[model samples]
Target: MGLEASNQGFIWVVRRNNNVNGGEEEKNEWLPHEFGKRMEGKGLIIRGWAPQVLILDHEAIGAFVIHCGWNSTLEGVSCGVPMVTWPVFAEQFFNEKLVIEILKIGVSVGAKECNRVVERIVKREDIKEAIRKVMVGEGALEIRNRAKKIKELATMAFEVDGSSYCNMQSLIHELISYNA
Candidate 1:
């Protein structure tokens, strides 16, 4: 509902949980009624696992809505895409802080509590607002610039003389010497 209300083109990836399904009849009961029909052209819902990296790297992908997991956060950063953070558990809230506060590359959906999947803690308005902020709000350009700069830095870390490269080399040398 939020994505639709945002009036932005989006691709949503939905995971299939074996435990949640009680045969084909209740397969899509979790979604808003006639969601697919309403979002036909504006939104694409990919079931199961889609190519996340490929989607993020696409030029049309303006912002990422994520759970703020470490890998997803890093992926969003590495891809130079700003995000709408909706953290649920574990280290996710910390990661959201990194993205929203430290990095200034994301907007939070005001998800404070970490609960089970059955609870819908974040409201549609919150999601819409966060997505709007990341996509076209006042700070959107600055956030995007920061995201791109971080991506460049992340990419540079792998260059021959870059910090990460140098560190890797040092580690390899130390290990070789110890083994010798």
Candidate 2:
């Protein structure tokens, strides 16, 4: 599956180090061997545990194929990178619902039978289409711009007169007066 997916020009960045016994070491060894052959001359970067990957920091990473984890969802939203949701289990379905229905920041795979480990393989065409939809389609640029505005607001909230900064100052003043 990895080989086939790689051949289709999609890099597979798997998160195999989360809460599983010896999973990190195993994935570190296996992932390179499994996906390395196809990586020659191709722009493929693999890592065992890079939480920031979902944050859309890489310019080349035009889209995210995620499992709908809440942290991952927020990171993606904060970064203004669009998503291609592939919910694996648990509340991921709900997260997908929010991304597609509420936020309109992404598209869901829409696979039924959420309990099964069906893999929910996505083809190359689907990936390309989703990338195009998020990066080039109508309203995509508007959504990205809105996300950028929100990110700027979050940054500003930590400045001297910002909401978080003022709250912290108030708390410190209260503590000092109490001590006095």
Q: How large is the C-alpha RMSD of every model relative to the true structure?
A: 2.4, 5.2
lDDT of 1: 0.90
Model 2, 54: alpha-carbon shift in Å? 8.5
* lDDT, each prediction: 0.90, 0.66
* Model 1, span 71-143: residue lDDT tens: 9888898899999999998899899999999999999999887766557567889889999998999999999
Tens digit of per-residue lDDT, candidate 2, span 99-175: 87777778655544464666555555665555556656686686566556665775687788999899999999999
Clashes in each model (backbone N, CA, C under 3 Å)? Answer: 0, 0
